[model samples]
Target: MDFDPLPDKPAPDNPSGKLVLLRHGETEWSRAGKHTGLTDVPLTPHGEELARNAGPLLSGYDFVLELCSPLERARRTAELAGLHPEIDPLLVEWDYGGYEGRTTKEIRKELGYNWTPFTHGVIRGENSPGETVEEVAGRASRVLTRVLPAMAEGDVAIVAHGHLLRILTSVFLRMAPRFGAALTLDAGSISVLAFYREEPAILTWNHGPGLPLKPSES
Candidate 1:
């Protein structure tokens, strides 16, 4: 385990830490495949159950820092998981803007093309003014800056939205923000980021409750 190194900074000689990334449980928009950002939605009953079930998987680790999005859904998930987490604005979901509350299919139908947030980005509207991938990445970087120092002390946990966490994962690996398109995080799933021989690596990803834990490779 190693703390996240700053971009353009040299790695420390000896480092030990792990980042546990948790996506908040389901909401109506999430279940309906809508782009949810800044709506302050709550978790569904099943979603709360999912988060509660995740407690066992997370209980094994003693986290030095526990952070959750300021939004209700993420905070609620953290509560259900039995973790007292500080609210972090950086953990907020990507702003979908005009696309908010709309599915990709619905967007495609309106725009007459196969559009995605990763490439096409988003547009501002009367209701929601969207954000660029770079903007979200900037927030993610700030989060890393704050969390990396804490990581030196012990494991850290983050409960947030799907798109934001994927972007954060890309930032963690020093990959281009667009690379976030390749990572898919389901609601209530967990992913672990740690060091492998001084390099960042994803130890486990998209793990849900009741799934068998595979033995780590020697």
Candidate 2:
């Protein structure tokens, strides 16, 4: 809850701060390539293992603020990762609306054309009323407003969903929300955002525990 107010403009020299972004472990829906928004799903056993393994990767950092989505998946991932994070609704995943339980392939089969959440958006349905890319970007901006101040103190960690985190990163870099389409975040992966030469930059991205590293790098 404690964070600094957003400055009208960033300082020219020192970096603003670092943000450590993490996507929750895999869920049945995620494994099936279904759009999961506002759905409360638990992680698979393998997913739990993924989260546990991520602990050591994050244990060394000193975070001033730690937050996670209220969804069970994100909260559980944080716990498994050895982090006690506050719940932040703003960190929830994109509202997929009518596409809630469907995959792009299924949707395409129905629509007779390729469909993507990033460009076409979602149709408002009884079960799921989808959100626009711009709307998602707006929420991402609000999240930055809260975390930027905390970043001034030290690093901050946000455990959230794949789509939301990517959009958040795009907003962090002052890029269009659609640009998030280019960033692929795997389940239980960690990405780091920091300042380079006093400008926002990605220090590391989509690093999974299973990734191979050279002896010296490891």
Query: RMSD (Cα, Å) of candidate 2?
Result: 5.7
Best by lDDT: 1
lDDT of each: 0.83, 0.82
Q: What overall lDDT, based on C-alpha atoms, would model 1 receive against the true structure? A: 0.83
lDDT of 1 at 3: 27
Poorest 10 consecutive residues of model 1 by lDDT? 209-218
lDDT by residue (tens digit), candidate 1, 88-110: 98789998888888888888999
lDDT of 2 by residue, 29-147 (tens): 88788888888989988778888888999987889999999999999999999999999888888888878878888899999988788878888868767788788788878888778
Off by over 4 Å in 1: 1-14, 211-218
Q: What's each prediction's clash count? A: 3, 3
